[model samples]
Target: MTATDGIRVVTLAGEIDHDTGDTLRHALDATGESCPRIVIDMGQVTFMDSSGINILIAAHRALSEAGGWLRLAAPARNVMRTIHIVGIDALIDCRETLSQALSD
Candidate 1:
């Protein structure tokens, strides 16, 4: 995790399924109410399933309710496809690069 440009960036790697989804959820929750804007660096995330999507949606809802937002950055092709399939790409901003997410 890193904090720069007034955003908290959480770098995730590998597959995020039921087994690993909790880790991501915990990381999101750890951001706390103080730090609402989050950029999840998914450049290294090769796969994601429903569980992963659920966690992301939950985080987004929490952040949005707090008047903040969550962004996804650089998801792998397959992961991006999954996110789109679940329609999360519409609810959250998905960027091709971390810099883009941090920029806007």
Candidate 2:
């Protein structure tokens, strides 16, 4: 994870499921404390389950309480579908590219 211009970028790879949710949760928790804007790069993620969504929702809540926000950037189709299906897209901003996410 890295931050620039008040936007933190977390680039995730591989699948996000119950097994990997803890790691992702930790990363998000660490950043959510201070960063007002977080952009998660999901371009490399091949899959995402409910567990992954739960982590995102938790992080979103944390950031919101601090007057911060979370964004999802360049998520793969499968991941995007899951996000949309779960209505997370309505709660968070989903960008088409990392550059766009950072710029916004």
Candidate 3:
């Protein structure tokens, strides 16, 4: 993970599922004390399941309620489709590019 202009860019790869949910939950959210602005770089994420969706929703709600936000950037079609099917795209900003996500 890296930070750009006060926003965190977390680049995720491989698959996100029940097996990886705990680690991902911690990685996406390190400190609950501060409001966090983050962009998830999903260009390399190949698959995601309900566990992944739950983690994302938890992160989004935490960030939003704390005056911050979360964005999903450049997710693969499969991953993006999962997000769309679950309506997570409506709760978080989904961008087509990393540049757009950072700027937004």
Per residue, candidate 2 scores C-alpha lDDT tens digits across 1-104 of: 99888777899999999999989988887452654778999999999988999899998998988888888999988889889999999998999999988885
Pairs clashing in candidate 1? Answer: none
Provide TM-scores for the models.
0.93, 0.92, 0.94
Instruction: Compute the lDDT of residue 99 as modeled in candidate 2.
Output: 91
- Best by the lDDT measure: 3
C-alpha lDDT of residue 34 in model 1: 65
The positional error of residue 55 in candidate 2, measured at the CA in angstroms, is 0.5
Name the candidate, 2 or 3, with the larger TM-score value. 3
Minimal lDDT window, size 10, model 2: 28-37
Query: Which regions in candidate 1 have their CA more than 4 angstroms from the true location?
Result: 30-32
lDDT of 1 by residue, 1-104 (tens): 99887788999998899999778888898444664899999999888888989999999999988888899999998898888888999999999999999995
Q: Write the number of the candidate with greater lDDT, choosing between 2 and 3.
A: 3
Off by over 4 Å in 2: 30-35
- State residue 17's C-alpha deviation in candidate 3, in Å: 0.4
